[model samples]
Target: MKKLLLLSISLIISGCASFGEGVTTAFLNKQKEKDLRECRVDGKSFGGMQGNYDGSNNLLKVLMVHGVGTHIPGYSTQFQEKLAAELGLDEMSSHYKEIKLVNKEYPDQDLGVLRVRRLLDQEQDEEMLFYELTWSSITNPQKEKLAYDTSGEYSFRRAEVNQMLKVFSNDTSPDPMIYLGKHSQDVILASFRTAFCWMMGRDWDALPNESQELCTVGQTAVEHLPDEDFAIISHSLGSRIVMDGMKSMASRVSKAQEGEPTSTEAAFITDFQKKRTPFYLMSNQLPLLDEAAIAEKNSASLKFKV
Candidate 1:
C-alpha cells in the first residue's frame, strides 16, 4: 500500500503542468520561444533539459536528480520554485539563465534554468549554483515509443507489468528477478548517460563520437564552484545517481594517483563535493514498504561514500 501511494505521488508530481512564459533554451540545439512550444508538444512531457548555467562563474553548486516515471522538463523548474519558497528565498528576484558552450566539443542543444532563492550568509554574500539534472529523457514518452519500436529493452507489455507485480507480491509462479533486473538496468543506464553528460560539463543532449567515450569532467564539474561548499538534493532514484557519480569520479581520481595516467579532468570530481556538501533527499521511497528489499540494497550502496 505504501509503495502504491509513493508511486501515485510521483505520478501526480510529474504530471502537473505549470506553463510559465519563461524562455526555453539549451546548448547544441537552443530553440526559439516558438520552437520551445513545438518541442514540448513533440515530446509530450519533456520540457527540455538545460544545464541552468549562466556565463558567470559562481562557485557553490547543487545537483538535483529526479526519480522514476515519465517526467517533463518542467519538473526541474517546479522543484526549484518550491525549494526557494521553503528556504524563504524570493523567486521573483531571480531568473533562469540558459547557457551554451560554443566550442567544437558540445553540440547545440536545449537548456533550461531556474535561478531561484539564493541562500545568504551573515556576510551578505550570495553564492551557490543549483543544477537540476533533467534526466527524464529515459522516462520520456517519445523516447519510450522509439525504444519500444526499435528494441524492446524498456517496453513493458501488460503481462510483463503483471510479472513484475508478481515479484513485488511474492508470487513464485515464475522467478521475475531477471525480468526486473533487465528493466531496472535499462532505465538506470539511460538516466546515467544523461546525468553523466551533464555532470561532465557536456550538455545533456551531447552526442559522443563513440559510445564508450567519456570526457574528463572534473574541471567542468567545478566550473561553477564559487565556494568550496556544495550540496545535493535528490528525489527518488536520483539518490542512486548522486552516490554512483561521486564514486565514479572518486575512482577516476584515485586511479590517477596510482600512476594510472587518468584523464586530467578526473582529479577534481570528488573534490567538487568534499567541501561542506550536504544532501537533502525528498520523496524518498526507502521508508515506504519495499517488499523486494530494493530499499535495503540502496541503503547498503549509499554507505561509505562522500
Candidate 2:
C-alpha cells in the first residue's frame, strides 16, 4: 500500500514542471481546493510578523517534515532541542514555544492538524529558526475507531475521527495507510496546506470557525524570512511528502511567472530557489526511495521565444 502510493504521488509531482498543472497531479489528482491560498484571507495578521521583522537572512531556517505514525506536540519540541544540542547550542529549553495549528487538540474535525514548535536563536550574522512540522494527527490509527455511545454518554465526551471517512459502517475497518492510500487525498493535501500556512507565518490560532477548508485559504504573507536559507528535514516516509510539496511549490512558481506581470507565487518560490532550499532526506527509506525519487526532466521538447 505504502510503496505503490508513494510511487504514484512522486511521479505526478517530480514529473510535472507547471504549477497550474502540477498541483492537481501533485495532489494525486484531487481538485477540491486548487484556488486555496497558503495564508489567511484577512489583512489583520496578513503578512504574519515577517512584514515587520527586518532581520538578516543569515539564519538557518528548517521546516522539519515528519514521516508517518502517531506523534504529538512533544514530538516537535524534542526535535528542535536535539538539533540545537547537536549544533553545540546552549539554553535549549528557553528557546522553545508550543503552538498548534488551530490552538486545540482534535481541532474540530480537520483533515490534518499542524503544530510548530519554533526555536529561535539569532546572533548578528548567525541565526537559526527550526519550525518542526508534525502531521500525525491525520495519519494515525485511532481515526478508525468509531464512537458508539460507550458508557451511554452523549454530552460528556469530545468529538474526534470525523475526517476522511465521515461514516463508519458496521462491517468496515479503517486501513492504517489510509493517509497514503485512497480516501486520503484531502488528508495529505491538508498537511501541505497547513505547512504552507505556517511557512507563510499566519496567525493560525485565529483560524475562523466556519472555515472548513481553511487549508485552501490565501494570504500573500512571507512564507519564509527574507534573505534566509530554507531547508527541509524529512524523516521516514515523510521524505516523499517533502518532495511532493517542493515540486508543487516550484511548479506553482513556474505557472505564476506566466502571468501578465508575474505573480506573488512566482516571486515567493523564486526567492526560495535563490536561497537554494536544501532537502535533508533523513528518512529511513533512502535506499528504497532512491530509484523512484530520481527526478525526471524534459528538456529537449521545449522551444524558446524569439
Candidate 3:
C-alpha cells in the first residue's frame, strides 16, 4: 500500500510539471508570433529593383527622418520598411539612407556624407507626410551602466516612437516625414535634403536657402513635403533642436504677418507668434528653450514624457 501511494504521488507531480512546461512553451510561441507580426512586410514591391516609389496607385507619401546615433540602413531601415509595408506600399523601398563619415571637415570637425532615397510613386498625385523618429543614448555613465542591466533604455525608445505615432495619427493634416535621430547634425541635414530632392525630383541646389539653414532645417525639410500635415518624432537633444527650429519658424511667420520684412532673422521672430503649428515632443526630460518663451509662443504644443 505504501509503495502504491508513493508511486501515485510521483505520477501526479510529473503530470503537473509537464502541464506547466507546455503552458510556458505555448506562451513563448505566442510572443514570437506577436513580434513577427510587428515586423512583417505586407505590400508588393513597386519597381523591379529593391526601391519603393509612390507608384501611380498610391496616394499618400510618408517621409521618415532618423535621430541621433541612428542612420539609414541601421534600425531605422527596418522600421521604415515595416511602416511602408503596413501602409500598403510594400513595393516601395525606404527613402532615407545612412550618413557616412568621409573625413574631418577641419580639425575636430567631422564632415559626414548623407544618402537619402525617395519612397514615392512619381505617377501618383498623393499628399506627402513626414515622420521623424529618433533615439538617444543615456549621457550619464552610471545611468548607461544601469540601463544595460534593466531594459529601461530600449523600453524608452519604443515608448517614445509609439507616443509620437499616436500624435501623428491624431493630426488632421496629411502625413509627412518621420524624423529619427543619429549623432551628427550635418549628416542629418544632408540626408534630409537628399530625401527631399528625390521626393520632389528636383536638384539638390534648387532647395530653398531657408531650408538649408541650420535653424530652419526642420521647417525647410517639411515645407518641401507635398502634404500640409507633418509628424515629428524626436528624442533627447534632438527634441530641443526641433523645438527651437519650430519656434524660430513661428517667429519668422509672425514677423512676416506684421509686415516686417526687416531681415531673415526678424522674419523668424514674426512667424513664431503668427503660426499655430502643431508639434509633439516625446521623452524630453531637458528643457530646450526658455520655459517662459515657449509658454508664451507655443501654448498649443503637446509634450509627452516617457
Candidate 4:
C-alpha cells in the first residue's frame, strides 16, 4: 500500500514542470541582470575567465575553470557575479583603467578590475586575479559541432554546444551556423584552428599536442601573473580540468624547487586551503568509469546530495 501511494505521488509530480527542475528560468533571468551589473561596476567582461587583476598593493588571485565545451567569458561572468556578491565587493570601485579587447572575435573581452570588499587592515591594499582555461576545440562553433558529430551524437551535442556558445558569447546576434548539424573530425579541427589563430597568432597546423597544448596555455597564464595568494573554482567538466592543471602545476613546482630553499610554492599551497578553494559540482554525471574508483578519488571532499 505504501509503495503504491508513493508511485501515485511520483506520477502526479512528474507531470508538473516545477518539480525537480534545477534553476528556474525566472531565477536565471534575474541572475543575468545581476551579473551584468557586477561586470559593469567592476569593469570586467561578463565572460572573462582568466587573469583579472584589481590594482592594489596586496595581491590575491583566482582561477576559474570551465567544464568541457564551455569558454571563459560566459562561464566566468556568471561565477564572478556570485563571488563578488559573496565577498561584498559589489559597490567598491577603484580608479584603475580597464583592459581593452584586442581580439576582434571577442570585442567584449577585458582585463577585470577587482573591487576590495574587505580589508584586514586599513594600511593594506587587497588585490585579486582571475584566470580561465578554455579548451581549443570548444571555442569555435564549427569545431564543437564537429566534435559532437564525430562522437556519434551530433544532434544532441550540437544543440547543447550551440546553447553554451551563445551563453558564452553573450551575443544575441543570429547565428546561421546553427543548421549545419553533421560534424566531422576535420570540421572540429578547423574550428579549433580559427580560434587558436586569433589567440596565439598562429595557424591551426602549428598547434601543440593536446596535453602540452592545454597545460601550456594554463601554466603560461599562471606564470605571467603575480604569484600571490590564490584560489581555484571549477564547475562541471571544469572540475576535471582543474584537477589535471593543479596536478601539472604541483609537479612543475616540485621539480623546480629541487634542492632549493624557498617558500614561494608554499604560499600558493596555503592559499588553496580547503575553505578558500571550495569545489562545487553541479548536475555532474560521471563518465563511464567504476563507482569505486570515483569514490576512492574524491572521497575526502565529495558531497552527494541526491
lDDT values, one for every candidate: 0.44, 0.52, 0.40, 0.39
Give each model's clash number. 19, 7, 57, 10
Lowest lDDT 10-mer window, candidate 2?
168-177
How close to the true structure is residue 282 of candidate 3, measured as C-alpha lDDT?
A: 48
Measured with C-alpha atoms, the lDDT of residue 50 in candidate 2 is: 33
Candidate 1 C-alpha lDDT tens digits along 173-212? 1121321354443444334434444433433233232232
- List ranges where model 1 is wrong by over 4 Å: 1-59, 91-95, 98-124, 141-226, 262-276, 286-306
- RMSD (Å) per prediction: 18.5, 21.7, 12.9, 16.1
**The best candidate in terms of lDDT:** 2
The TM-score ranking, best first, is 2, 1, 3, 4
lDDT of 3 by residue, 102-168 (tens): 2222223332233333344344333233333222211122123333423555446566767555434
| Top model number, TM-score | 2
lDDT of 1: 0.44
Instruction: Compute the lDDT for candidate 2.
Output: 0.52
Candidate 3: where is the Cα deviation over 4 Å? 1-9, 21-73, 85-95, 99-116, 127-229, 234-262, 268-306
Number of clashing pairs, model 3?
Answer: 57
User: Candidate 4: which stretches are off by over 4 Å?
Assistant: 1-59, 91-127, 136-227, 257-306
Tens-digit per-residue lDDT, 93-120, candidate 4: 2321121112333334321121112212
Q: How accurate is candidate 3 locally (lDDT)?
A: 0.40
